[model samples]
Target: MDLPQLGTNLLNRVPPRLLSAAERYLKSVPLLRNRLEKETDSMLAGLEGDLKPYRGQLPTFATLPTQGLSHEQVLGEMSQMKEKEEHRWKDGLVSGAVYHGDSEHIDFLNRVYALNSQSNPLHADLWPSATKFEAEVVAMTAHMLGATEANAGRPPEQHICGALSSGGTESIMLAMKTYRDWARETKGITRPEMVAPSTAHTAFDKAAHYFGIKMVRVPVGPDYRADVKATRKALNRNTIVIIGSAPSFPHGTIDPIEELSELARKRRIGFHTDACLGGFVLPWARKLGYPVPEFDFRLPGVTSMSADTHKFGYAAKGTSVVLYRGTALRSHQYFTATEWPGGIYFSPTFSGSRPGALIAAAWASLVSTGEEGYLDATRRILETADAIKRGIRAIPGLHVLGEPLFVIAFGSDIVDIYKVMERMSARGWSLNGLHKPAAVHICVTQRHTQPGVAERFLEDLRAAVEHVRANPGEKGTMAPVYGMAGTVPFRGILSDLLKKYMDLLYKV
Candidate 1:
């Protein structure tokens, strides 16, 4: 029989769970395992060549060369790689990686980094400037998120405060760990749980796995916003925190933070507003008269928030801000050790010796792009996003998933959206393919706001949709993988495939 007939026979013969287990066992057999290994090796061999293009051209350094390479040689190699990689992002053919690609800003930040490359925030006395930058970054981010209003009459310890983390994942993990500890100590609850929307970032799940907290995910409503009533039902005495997103990463739909936080507030539990994607944009979007909701400390219920300075803030990578309603709650995130062989030791985030240059870069980005600059940038990004959304809606069989600002997700009723995404990839557009609803999205940034970028994107997208509609039988690359990953009954098999793929990343 053919592939379709076989698939139908398998589905008609047995339940999915048993079939999944049997397939898993069959794949574990020696002959099948060998075939799998051969296929994986062949695939990775192609990826290896692409990842290490200079392997044959450059001198090998399995062990560092007997003598050090000259600075000129190192710079030449790096410059070559940079030249090769910068064109796509610089010319606006990609998605959300490079937020601010202006050469002047990059050069300015590089100068700041060079001046402070030797500094380390772990040694406060050695780098007082780093401490100043860190404190100010936190303060400025807090003030932008309504700290001044939240702490109007509060004491310093009871006022909004936080620390700088490497990125959004670290910030979120830090908050989750803090709540787990706080709940255990203050409420004497051994079992800890946190409620969050289904659209919440995977970092929360990672936090739950790492910190031993139970994560309860409440599904979103028809509009793709969090279901506040469902979230209320998911809470219990053991619920230490509740979470909402200010424009989630997948669909970019802002949750009903006001209601969710109010629910948490009435229960006297922590409420974390994950604004990692929107923290820098929404504040300005609200100022621009966008329909933004209360997802900050201005609400009495919100106790914590995570924002990425790297994304829309136009800061360098390796910097994010996690703010708490009060310093007392943030104190639980601190790590201190008094019994070390050396002197006392303490750290606010995960890393022991953090790079001060990144802190300086973050500070410089914020200072250079003040309120006026951010507002202008947000305006451009939103306008570009609006154009893309409108264009997608106009295309036949395609519909915008939800009301989004900078990140717009679209799906199709008559064609496989993944196939369309594959066609878009072929046309030099790198978009995010989302599952569950099987859609795709492009996160508009400063790069996309450049002249003709939005029009080109829409034109290519329309052509791709028409092509997919004409060639319905053509199974393009990556579409089947996406389809299988999304619809497969054996989730464990997919998880294993991911693990193997990650392992390949480390292979030299």
Candidate 2:
């Protein structure tokens, strides 16, 4: 076949309906499979250089080196990478990566981490401090999210309890798995389903796929909040849980957890509130008189919630807390295999071994940054966010989505937002690009709280918008990606590209 005809033939064979059959038929042909694999390997070869940037400059060890590298060499390389990555976040030129960038606070957390580096919670007998620190971290996070108010006169078992997970995704996945098990055991639900806002984190969908649960994603209303009626309609028999976010990742709009959780309560199903991005900041912002919604255990029907200590909580990057209304609900998340040759192999989370240093850093951060500290930090962050929101709103042709507090998403109808995003990225601002409705978001953090950071952001954003307006046909890297996805008829190509991207990420 000619090149054009061959391309058309391959494209025509890749339809969604024909995908499974194509895969089967193609796999049955060894030559076709070999050709495809070879092409993929060659394409991926071009990406391996970018993936392993430290190839010759530093030693790359997939396994333990026979001779340990000097500690100085390891620290030197880490310092070099930190220096390269820190300028944007440290100088307040980026979004959401480094929450609290004050050197003193980071040093303190690092000190705490160093103190507990050798401790492992899995070996509680050897390092009781790890368990104690983790327990306290959970307690502190729980109380911050309204556990104390919810369990004022309740029994110890009824009080809020939780486990510290690796990050927000783990916390959310653990909660979903818990609900799945709870529904199966208690309500005789074999095929469980969860009702979640379309704006809910993708982690819920990940959990549903991994745990054999059906995820019914209900769309958000015009204001970007979850549609309560749609959520109610989505729930049916075998519904295990309903999920809402304090402030969703896409539009930064808080869902009406009070109403949604109440609906779940009426149905006697579990309700989970994902507050990973906002849990630590919203309480203080509300106390500071910012308009915040009720999205915690303080609500009568919210059975569980997940909050990241890494984001706004100012701890290290590996820790988040998942709280349940009671110990019974959390027990569903544990694993125990008493008959194993390993002799009672058990773990509270997915991983067998846990990082104790992260737990210690989390605990230390909580204690060091008390209510007073959080209140002050929230004041700075909210004030900065307010300035940013106002600045973005003032710019012509651009609009901020929802009445958000900290995390702000804005887009333009008159210009391509992805092109604008590409401009911001070129100017050394790493912001998040959102699709489905095609918007870009800048998640405000402590980095943006620095002097003139918000002003610089506004200035850069205005310039970016102007550039995109002038050059309407500017095709940048992600601009074409988002544009193609939005305007294309076939999503199978996007799926394949995403799979390839994932493979690239894990190539090394």
Candidate 3:
């Protein structure tokens, strides 16, 4: 066995605390640190070309130009780059980056953005329209996610309410922070913790790290959904909330939200349904006769939810909605600084000065798309996803990970899935690579609903799988990297590698 693999195996046998100490000590050693730096630098060097493709092609700016470039010149350069990069997503060759890529929708949103370019929701006095747009966006999203049903016989203050966020990550982080504050104040829980399935999004982990909350992740069930028994066992007095996904990112399987939320309700703890992926689709999916479980505010135990307007909502890229069961819980998410010299500052979300243009775009997308538009879009996307799932299952060695509606994950017992992903990449397809079972997923979007896109994807995927099976000995550029990432026991090493990659992104 290779030396690194052997070392990883040895480390895996060590106790958790001791292993962490050993990892720290190993990094403290100058020689070991230097060797790691050299290897990381070399690996990053290989990726620099693809990441910085315009290095030699376009003008590089270490600092600003002596004088500002003409608007025409700037637009020309941007247009060139846009044309070069648009094809992959335009043709549905990518996974989830661009959701609704229709020209008319894009143009409409662009116009809305341009019109509200100077509006800032932070300065509501100056731009009441921005606030109107944001409030309506939140209300519209909340109603769609069962706020109306949840509001039945309840006071307005107890009705479902929400705030506009930049995206899903912010919405999730906002809810987590809100829960942390709420638990600390109401439950008197000094040390906060959250219980979630292993399939919950990494944003929860980020929130835990940032907010000083302990994250307890339980194992998923055989069907790739959250294990209720395991989740119940993981909860404790310190658990501020329980998290369930409407449809998880990796496996595209919805956790048993009903049972999970009930557990939280019985405990009197918060239950957050992260519907960021399925929020816009599942509600419509259920209306279209799909088996979507109760995951919204309609569930009594569901105290909060996050829905991205950017993903399936057909909004422009930057807006999402985070809802609370009542105004009281949402109050914990607010930030008000009366002590500041800036004259009683207050902000709803993380950012103080927010892009009201994106809010306007989100509002515009929702109002324009309406219910029928979302239903039609959801129908096409789910139908396309069904076809894709069938095709993946038909591929001899591959199997769909779960019974998914739109987002589809697949794996193979007979082939190196990572190698198959690499082959797909070579054929100009961009797909998400998932680990902890090692699979790949395609988040079916409206782009994939276009004519022949599903068929094209299946054809390319079949060819890629056959190629991987026929040439088992062939080395792949990213396949080995993905393989190592999935199997390596030393998570700290991989984390460091990712940090270095993030550094590389800022290197220009």
> Which of the numbered candidates is closest to the native, going by highest lDDT?
3
Cα lDDT, model 3, residue 322: 96
Question: Could you tell me which residue pairs clash in candidate 3?
Answer: none
How well is each residue in 417-483 modelled by candidate 1, as lDDT tens digits?
9999989988988889998788998989999999999999999999999999999999875787688
The number of the candidate with the highest TM-score is 3
The lDDT, on a scale of 0 to 1, for candidate 1 is: 0.90
Each prediction's TM-score against the native? 0.94, 0.90, 0.97
Q: Which lDDT tens digits does candidate 3 get at residues 193-262? A: 9999999999999999999999999999879999999998998899999999999999889999999999
Better of 1 and 3 by lDDT: 3
Q: Which regions of candidate 3 deviate over 4 angstroms?
A: 1-13
Judged by whole-model lDDT over C-alpha atoms, candidate 3 comes out at 0.92
Over the stretch 356-469, how does candidate 2's per-residue lDDT look in tens digits?
999999989989999999999999988998999999999999999888888899988899999999999899888988876788998888888888889999999999999999
The candidate 2 region of ten consecutive residues with least summed lDDT is 485-494
Q: By TM-score, how accurate is candidate 3?
A: 0.97
What would the C-alpha RMSD of candidate 2 be, to one decimal place?
Answer: 4.5
